[model samples]
Target: MATSKFLFGLLLLLILVEMNIIEQPWMPGVEAIDCSGKCNYRCSKSGRPKMCIRACNTCCKRCQCVPSGTSGNKDECTCYANMKTHNGRPKCP
Candidate 1:
């Protein structure tokens, strides 16, 4: 019984270590920022705030970062830089 408990504890430790070593897809670069807040911050400067939030939220959810200003700074997040709408329009604000 004691040997079984020891093996279970060892397995649990391995899992914890593995989790610490892996990086999350949503937080590729910068420290994780709340997508909703990022979207709101950028959209505030937009002429079309509602549309900007909608678009920014989509990109932020995927890329986990919002570009600076009202438009065009996609280099910060490669995923956001590459995104496109169904109509081929830029997807991120």
Candidate 2:
């Protein structure tokens, strides 16, 4: 019975991972996300891709994560969401 329960738990954990309900832990240096690629995608719709990419790079370096879409997904990465410019506006696109 105990063995069966353990197996069930392990199976459930695997399913969660596969479904992306659970994600791998973040550890800098151990794993690095493709910031350039992610930022490019995130900034693709911007009028100023160069400026957007530059700001995104800075935010990604600090937060180690980028929001999942081209826009309005800042809630996905709080650090990115919270970043501000000198005038106290959202910095990351």
Q: Residue 61 lDDT in model 2?
A: 89
Candidate 2 least-lDDT 10 residues:
23-32
Candidate 2 pairs with clashing backbones: none
Off by over 4 Å in 2: 1-30
lDDT of the candidates, in the order given: 0.80, 0.89
| Per-residue lDDT over 1-93 for candidate 1, one digit per residue giving the tens place of the 0 to 100 score | 999999999888778756866554544654656988878988887888998899888888777777776667778778888889999987888
Over 4 Å off, model 1: 1-32
- Which number leads on lDDT? 2
Model 1 TM-score?
Answer: 0.61
lDDT of 2: 0.89
Name the Cα RMSD for model 1: 5.9
Clashes of 1: 0
How displaced is residue 71 in candidate 2, in Å? Answer: 0.4
